[model samples]
Target: MILGFGMDVVEIARMARILAGPPARAERFLARVFTPAERAYCDARQDRAGRYAARFAAKEAAVKALGAPAGVRWSELEVIRAEGAPSLTLAGAAAAAGARLGVARVFLTITHDAGVAAAAVILEGAQR
Candidate 1:
């Protein structure tokens, strides 16, 4: 069953500014907001701004879908792609929050275009 749903949009320019800033500041911002894998994946892309924006939106959407639980860190929710399909892998506080909420799995979708990035998330509950 569907436990929760959420969607978010981000401006590509916002992420671009953070990435294009001074090294130390950029690193700090990235480190606080994104996981290592997510940083690697987006940094490897030609359109890093779009990729990062999409991932940012995905993280926000995941948190909203998870009911904005306390102590859920941003880096704990990773946006992963396999064979071009996007999904969420929660760890740390995010995983614990999901467990508490009975979220069996989280479905994710992300898209970017026209200087904007968007993501949608659906939290599925465990079978009773």
Candidate 2:
């Protein structure tokens, strides 16, 4: 069964600008949105722009997968990489919301082309 689904697109320039702003804002934003592992991966990557784009797409895709509205904060859904693939780790209200939505696991894919990055998320639930 399908629990939920989400997809998102982002402009590389926008994310780059956000990252370039006050360091505190970026830190706070990243703390809320990304898991430790995810943060580590991004931090270790030499392609900062690619890392930013991936995270941005993941956040957008997560909101869609959860079937939530725009107000859903980026911090609610975190994207991590495992074995070179993207995965999801939900926290706080995001977890509860996922449960309410009957989502058991979330799968995510992120890609970048030219100057744009995009992501797609799939939520899997118990087969009914």
Candidate 3:
């Protein structure tokens, strides 16, 4: 059963600007919002801004789909690379939200093109 669904889009240029701002400020934002592995993956790519923006959109979509409660930190919704596709892992408050909603599976899709990045999330509830 489907629990919820959500989608989000972000401007790559805007994300680029955010990531390219004052060193200390940008670092703080990145460290606060993204996990260490996520930062490493995006930083190693040529389309760094696009990767970061896609991940950000994915997080936003996941949060929306989960109907997560307040205090759900950005880093708690991590985009993970799998063999076939990318997936999301919830932690802390995010996990609690999924459990509260009985979400058993999550479907995620992300893309970047034409100066924009977008993501969609589908929350599947556990079967009885």
Work out the TM-score per prediction: 0.95, 0.84, 0.97
- Candidate 3's residue-wise lDDT over 1-128, tens digit each? 99999899999999999988999999999999999999998999999999999999999999899875798999999999859899999999999999999999999999999999999999999787
**Backbone-clash count (model 1):** 0
lDDT of 1 by residue, 21-122 (tens): 898999998999988888889888999999999999999999999889889888899998868789899999989888888989899999999999999999
Lowest summed lDDT window (length 10), candidate 2: 67-76
Clashes of each: 0, 2, 0
Give the range of the ten consecutive residues with the poorest summed lDDT in model 3.
62-71
> 96 in model 1: Cα distance from truth in Å?
1.2
Residue 64 miss distance in model 1 (angstroms): 0.5
Ranking by lDDT: 3, 1, 2
The candidates, ranked best first by TM-score, are 3, 1, 2
Which ten residues in a row are the worst by lDDT in model 1? 76-85
Best by TM-score: 3
Model 1 residue 68 CA deviation (Å) reads: 0.8
Model 1, runs deviating above 4 Å: none
| Model 3 TM-score on a 0 to 1 scale | 0.97
